[model samples]
Target: MLRFFTRSVLSLIVASASTCPARSSSASRPAFIAAFALSPPSAPSTSCQATMTASVAAESTDLPRWDLSRFGFSSPFSDEIDLHLEETAKLAEAFKAKYEGKLGELSLLSAIQDYEEISKRKTLVSSYLHLSYDVSLDDDTLKKRKGALSQRQSEIYGDNLEWFSLDVAELDDAVLASQYENDPSLTKFKSFIDELRRQKPHNLSKDVERALTVRSPYVGNRPLVSFFDKELSLMRFKLDEDGKEVNMEVLLSRMQSSNDAAFRAKCLQVLNEGLAGSVSRTAALSLSSVAGGWLVENKERKYINLRSRRNLDNNCPDEVVDSLLVGVRSAGIPLCKRFYTLKKGILQKTQGLDKFRWSDRNAPIDIGGVSNEKISWEAAVAMVKKGYNQFSPKMSEMFVSMVEEKRIDVPAANGKKGGAYCAGVIPGVGPFQLLNFDGTKQDVATLAHESGHGVHDILAYEQGYLQYHPPLTLAETASIFGEMIVFRDLLAQSSSKEEELTLLMSKIDDVVNSVVRQCSFDRFEELVHTAREKGELSADELDEYWMSALREYYGKEGDAGGDSPFDSYENTSHLWSYVPHFHHVPFYVYSYAFADLVVGTLYNNFLTNKEGFEGRLLALLSAGGTKDFANALGPFGLDPTSSTFWTEALTAHLGELVNEAEKIAKELGYVE
Candidate 1:
């Protein structure tokens, strides 16, 4: 989970329970991988890179490390810590003593400097051992403190206080914008401040606004909705064919290894049981309530629809988002379903092929294990480097600097989360990544994906902290495009049918998840919010609504009208509980679906029009936090304002997948 737009000392990092940092406010906090949600990859092999497991803590590594001194963090933690309540109280006292209502440039500069110092102290909090304060990622004390700081931050940033001075309003909006012209670093601050001023007329009284800003952390849903997503360390599922114990992740990813329906069902059951476990269910409830509360507030905020606030924050226009959903659901979701039917026919089954298990979607192909062998870590790194280099020599160069310089710390080690992520520390300093690097082909792609994020962060970092992050809707461009690069390169190298099939199927599955699943989540959130506004949503009521949405996206369930016992009470109460977004930001899911197709368009353009394409892409990445989604996309001749813009992008890819899936089915002798 990460924030693209953090404004206070509390909004910095969204670390896990192990290294808990106070997340951003309810309005702006990004959810866990909500920015780049990757479902667990096909289970990895010791030899092949696949999905790695999520574990609890980091182990010591002997690799050469960065100075880390340049970031000004003497310790690993990023801010100052109060080892005890007295110390924290002192911090509160200090702020109140010196910072309550001082409205001068000098006062603001002092606050920023103090925050920078606090960041340095916070990073090394562990280095000093805050063992006595009860510091679980779920630590009660941490929650309390974060709640305090978050509330304070909200009071400041909410419609409560003026983010800028009255002096700003006195200058012409044009010349006022020019006030930060000399320094690019100040431009974003200037803009954000100006935006706040524009809404000054609608703001609560200054005292009320300041009070809201200061007390926001203490409010909202996350506090009441606490759930843990326990990482899997060791898991064994019974394999149907061999009757041998198999790693669930690995076995599920290898569904193509065997044509046994029994095996697929077993994998699904295993996964189902895992999510059905008591702890997971309880967590889901918390997530749902949090999401429900978010819906309530959105109604209060008076946004156009449940999804509109997210669009506004992403700086995306409504039409572009709508277009992406329309094109994908119409073209991509159905194609994915059709491909499943073809697989069923080829595999000698017909009863329930359309009911896809999470496992079978990306099973390793049965091309005699050809072309899908485990790639070495070096090979994965090289592929990513080459892909980035092909795009921009500088971008590629940064990849090397990161890997060789120990800027990256991925090797799929124990205690790291299952997926990959890039954390941009700041400008001048580069970003860091955490990855589970088993040697599967997907692992390599994951590297490319996160590296895409890494590259974007590096370029964006050029804009300094104020402009370093992109809006969520545009954040995935580099990462997904990075994936496209790897996929295209691999496609070029696939000399045989099996490898090509593997590539096509993989692409198809990705399209389904990104376009269909995420958009469905968006729609689901809308329902939850809309329903919650009318009345309080019980767990049963929430489940009923969830299944309704889930069925619509996946397909109507055959057992629905028969009063399935597990439908509400047992099925997916945790749907809302575990994901931090429902608690933090409502309707954040649309960004993924939007960004996925958008990447398709950008990649399509680059593939068809090579000259200056890389340059334009770089320019976009470099604009960072400053550009809205429209402006970020301007140079590429794209606009989210037009429904046609999104449809064209989705059509280009899904149309081909549908055609290829059909051809494959026909060749495999499946009936029309």
Candidate 2:
């Protein structure tokens, strides 16, 4: 989420987390496979040449890889990267020499402009390296180069520019006011400056800040998270008794897609086993270190609680997050139970299964006329484009440009990162999307989700680099909304009651995943972090916390030992070790739940009042971090601050989805 090894230390400190969920490996295949038409028999020599030519053509049709040259580098190892790094370092030095201790006397506008320029240059290099490192995680040379560059960037920013914020925060209010009045351009950064001022209470001494920044690359969660990712990338799971081992991605994909109940359970077993032992212990150590570091920093900053720092960073109040969590537990949890209860009945009747295991949570149900074939990459792109076009032509055009420009990486490969994410490098440049797409319905939805992030980045470009990134709470709005529109388009295209029911069940699964499941993750983090404060949490202790949270949300009306829909928690307790968010960004899972409900409300508004909704929604995305969650939703007649807002939204949106899916299932005789 922080681009763990690739982004500059300064960017890590200031930038919002990228829109990536927990890491789960899935199946991988060729991006695009060209269909060849048969021809009449011909001469052997001519046919051989023709076949070779056709092979080349098919290879050319493969999904486009990212063109990193756009970042002024031919490759991660290009000389241009070093040149830019040197230039940025020189510029940082000059800027520091000119205005390190004389912030009040110089033109604030000029200083801010110089700072922005330096940040942009550093970010360009960092983003390029991060993207490169993500695809080539197995390349040790690239990994080392990325590490060295990251350390140098950290040194440059820490030694030369760390005092800028401290000095600005220390500036008298009257002085800042005068600068804004005298130079209207300075007003452009008032919000930026005010944000700094808001952190005045937590601002450490300039020397201390510099020390912390310079040492960041060598210490803290970054290095540990990097190690965790590398370990995860290299892990292999046994897929069959023949000893055919696959990467995590393939195993996870099989777990979800395999129709054989025994095989699905086997995939889950291998997945948990692969993540056990050394990997699990390493993950536990890394997580403990992260929580320990966060606790120390929060204590130093005198924040109210563990989550308050992230809440403040998101421009969301603690009470709002509290209300959101409470609502999810009270209303959202019940909705989850009901949905799963219905699903249990459907599986029992349709598949003749006696028990429902965690692997069956995403299992595909057999339905008449529902195709299990993979959607081709090209077709997936067109489907998402049509979905966007249904909402806004402008957005559809932007999505097309992103694909055409080769800014998206669409295939899953060995050593490539497992999850999906969209990284917004800077204001002027479009974001790059990384996905381990295996051509499932979920992958199509993920494509829509990340494209939504890209469009959000494009729409917010006018806000400038400092304000372009939205708060985490609002970041998922466009992505989820994009997913919803595409879902509706898919539903509209369904021709049969069986197909409709299948799609409806899939949508309900996603809703529960995005809302209740994510809230459950948040609860897990809360437990771990809270326990971690007293002492270091052991691997077994982390497992306990995980199972506790799992049962709380996934468990049903009866006790854990009774007739709960889920099987025993043995296979899933270690799953907490693999989620990257828990390591990269603490307490970040709740934002997914928050955004899903928010999008649900806005989506409903769009459905009821089609007129001007596009403009309003685009305006909300365009506002970026400038507007807080509440103010951004003001136009939609929604108030997230109200105690009942989340509960009401959950019932109206997810609850209704469950009801509809259940009705269709019952009508089809799958549920009684």
Per-residue error (Å), model 1, residue 648 = 1.6
- Give the poorly placed runs of model 2, Cα more than 4 Å off: 1-18, 21-61, 556-560
The RMSD of every model to the true structure, in order and in angstroms, is 7.9, 10.1
lDDT tens readout by residue for model 2, 495-550: 98889888888777777876787788788989999998899888899988988888
Query: Which ten contiguous residues of candidate 2 have the minimum total lDDT?
Result: 29-38
What's model 1's lDDT at 233?
A: 31
Best candidate, lDDT: 2
User: Candidate 1: minimum summed lDDT over ten consecutive residues — where?
Assistant: 8-17
> Over the stretch 206-305, how does candidate 1's per-residue lDDT look in tens digits?
4543444344334434344422322233334564567765443344344433345456556555554554555355544555566665565455455566
CA deviation > 4 Å runs, candidate 1: 1-24, 28-191, 194-219, 224-226, 230-261, 346-359, 411-418, 534-540, 557-584, 664-672
